[model samples]
Target: MAQSNPRKSGYSFAPSPSSLGAGLSVPVGRRSVLGGAVGLSAMAALTACGGGGGGSDVKEGTGAISFGSNQSDAVPKAAYKKMIDTFKKDSGSKVSINTVDHNTYQEQINSYLQGEPDDVFSWFAGYRMRFFADQGLAGDVSSVWDNIGDDFSEAFKASATATDGKQYFVPVSYYPWAVFYRKSVFADKGYDIPTTLDEYISLSKEMQKDGLTPIGLGDKDGWPAMGTFDILNMRINGYDFHTSLLAGEESWESDEVKDVFDTWAKQMPYHQKGGLGRDWQEMAQGLLQKKTGMAVFGMSISQQFQGAEGGEALEDLDFFKFPKINDEHGTDSIDAPTDGFMMSAKTENGGTAKDLLEFLGSAEAEQINTEADKSIVGPATNVDTSNYTALQKKAVELVGEAKHTAQFLDRDTRPDFASTVMIPSLQAFIKDPKDINNILKDIEAQKKAIFTA
Candidate 1:
């Protein structure tokens, strides 16, 4: 759920609850406590050793550093390589990359960090970054931020900062989650973009009548469905409620949360069948082949069409904000997750690692990245977007116009709960929508245990 870059777009971060829901108090107490707990050791280490190098044992550069990357997909992998190769050429430093499968890397990150992690590794912003940083698994990159901070927006910087007010992650790019379709498909079918929930349902019904699956959904990887849940939750209950629920400050068993599930269940008939057996790439392929009428997906789904052998698959890609469900919320919130890099707490060459981070946070690096992967935009505000594709530009506009932004369900909540509880629980609902009460009860119980522990 995150894409392409916009320079001078005035791209902002999450808005306060006051801005989203009048008179609603956004609770940061729980999130603050979590951040405090996580930043303690990291801050202590930073104080003891001084600056971003982390600790006394952490050494200066040997001109060579290893990197762990989860960008196994060909497009992003090659894109990262182009950026890294340029870094090597520009800085005269040696980078050894240890690439892992994306899902496997995320599943094993805890152990990977506890063991001998690379000097720097690909990571995400928000709760996931703070979670590891709090456990003393990541290096303080504040020093790197000092040099590159001017290149980014305040929101982008906040995304990289833990509750400790210290920087642990360096964001490179982000994209928003929205309903995507092929312009050609809409034109050929004379379909209109839905601006309200009723209109959305009506359009789906029309697609069904035309012998096309109304929605493309694939959850074999378990995380994709969270996007649907996220947009629905925001549209129905508002952004404040969505964030509070993910923070474990709200009961999953509440009627509000149940309403989100109930609504999604009603739309199941419109979604592709057997989603549990399909992956996102397959879903994107179906969209590209025009077998499916529409898909609620992140801009990164463009990668699938970008790889197609021919036709205007990539060129025809377009999206609209998920239609409004509540007049009060009015399509105000979106999931625009930030993806970036973090230095390992145990990096052998702290100096070299920080040096690499400094380069990665530069406008030059972001330019190189966006040039390779049009699906993602750079976080740096100074990035030259002269070459941005039409799709990339619109993505930036969509995110910038939104009143509130979320980091997606998995990134917004505890990693433990997301992977262990929500993933399977959502899959269960997809398999059998009637099991709502049971799913909510199970989620609440697991959330309590996880959050309290």
Candidate 2:
């Protein structure tokens, strides 16, 4: 999408839900955040798992059901299948999975739900879930929640609850966004962890001098860059301001907001070149290959490390909170987005869908899911943790120690605004850093229109 001048476009603002919540539904705690076992698989030949496979033929009254999944990556894809296979064996039911690319699934969710969506599907928590629930795109899962409520923490439950005080999502796992690096690389280079902005920049320069890309980022999918923006904004402006700004209660043109872009622009020279053309998996490969010093990413990056060429490198993976920029905020916040599943309102069999949703929320299901994906942890409170890897254990500690937690930029705000405005705007900024002034103006104009509408 081209950058549009809202004034010249003369587009009328369409009224939207006025009360998009300002923060997470419930505060995230250490025990409440999740991580799973890190597993490896090659990215090649990993296309849509079940492309062109339709679920329209499944009978509503039969025990068989269809599912739409975005777990197309090798580890998670296999993990989801394991869970479904278990579901089939235990219940004597059939499940047909229609898998799509993760990004495509998210971008086309509106049409998917309105069209021939499967009985249940993968989704996320936060306002993204609420937005769909309010629009009647998601089926109410409060009844499912009632049976499994005791198995989860209040924070996890709240994350799944929509604005109407009803649950529409069943959280499966969560992980924090942080600056990740290979411990071996840092040790070999005699590098120290930087806790302040100046040190962080200086360290990046040293890495560049050492023939390593200081920061490996891939924004081809658009949402990856939002993580960088979210962290920078929270670091420089404080968590409250970041939330307010994204919630549309604050202006995009504010000095605080501009400072974030300015800082990012200064840091962009250290980012991998051609980032706009690369996907996150490639960027993760850079870190595993020792071509990059660090990457600001979620725990899901582990999937890439477990690849055929880099599987053993997963053990050396470690991360630190994004360095503090403003002393007032002092690295007090982090984005720990929760991943989960939701029932489609258009399901042919609500009974089976709800039953599967209940199973998904159970400790037994969480254990199976977390065991398959090495990077995430289950959200269920009673899920076994005796087997958590060191990486997963650290992730829980990192999130627990934070003073504030966000659901990530795309999940924290209006989905329409994120998909339509922020994704393109952030990508535009990445494509051309020199155009900051115009970018801020365009964002402000769009925010006004979208928030009011």
The candidate scoring highest on TM-score is 1
Model 1 TM-score, all chains together:
0.79
Backbone N/Cα/C clashes per model: 9, 12
lDDT on C-alpha atoms for all candidate structures: 0.78, 0.76
Query: Whole-model lDDT for model 1 versus the true structure?
Result: 0.78
Q: Estimate each model's TM-score.
A: 0.79, 0.73
Clashing pairs in 1: 2-175, 3-174, 3-175, 3-376, 3-377, 4-376, 4-377, 5-377, 38-134
lDDT for 432 (candidate 1): 98
lDDT (Cα, tens digit) per residue for candidate 1, span 413-434: 8766777788899999999999
How does model 2 fare in lDDT?
0.76
Q: Evaluate residue 54 in candidate 1 and report its C-alpha lDDT on the 0 to 100 scale.
A: 33
- Error (Å) of candidate 2 at residue 122 is 2.8
Model 1: per-residue Cα lDDT at residue 133: 73
